[model samples]
Target: MNARFTRFALVAGTVAVTTLGPSVQAQALPACASNAICLWRFQDGTGELYTWRGGYVDLPSRFTDHVGSFRANRTGAFVDWASGKECHSVRKGDYASNYSGRFGSKIDAVGDNC
Candidate 1:
């Protein structure tokens, strides 16, 4: 019985170590250029990456409902809704690990606020 308890403790300890370690912490966002905004198709900065520079622009059809993560390398990157409202703004050096459900797959445009 003691041996079984010890084995259980060991297993629990191993799981705690593996699941709560730094490796399981949030990852650094994927790279975006100095003056660009990058959106990813998966959270934690994984999957397809789409980059944008300056200008008022519509997200290409391929990415309209696909953006999941984002990093803003420029000072005033704005995520626009189809209703022509700015739903969220990402300042320079900022990152969003995930978007809200209402805006997540609904971002229709992107542009510089400055």
Candidate 2:
């Protein structure tokens, strides 16, 4: 019984280390969060996405490592450059600003912090 308990603890510890230690996708973008305002962020490395109805937030999305296929709402969105369509999504990274104020089809990468 003692051996079993020890082994169980070891496995649990290993799982925790692997799960949160490293970034899953070398190019899988990062994680995102909803700010007080509640908006989604999506950019190359870390940016926000503006919705039509909902204002700004720390939404969770990722940037397509490919450099194209990024389209969400309108703001911060641009032609795929390669695909000609807009489609970008990325999670929080390094750092990000706050989400508040007017929230509609258009968004600014950096805005006044809340």
TM-score top scorer: 1
lDDT of 2 by residue, 9-105 (tens): 9999999998889784434433333331223443333344332223333322342221221222222322233344333333222222321221223
Alpha-carbon shift of residue 60 in model 2 (angstroms): 35
| Weakest 10 consecutive residues of candidate 1 by summed lDDT | 75-84
| Residue pairs with clashing backbones, model 1 | none
Measured with C-alpha atoms, the lDDT of residue 36 in candidate 2 is: 17
- Cα lDDT of all candidates, in order? 0.76, 0.35
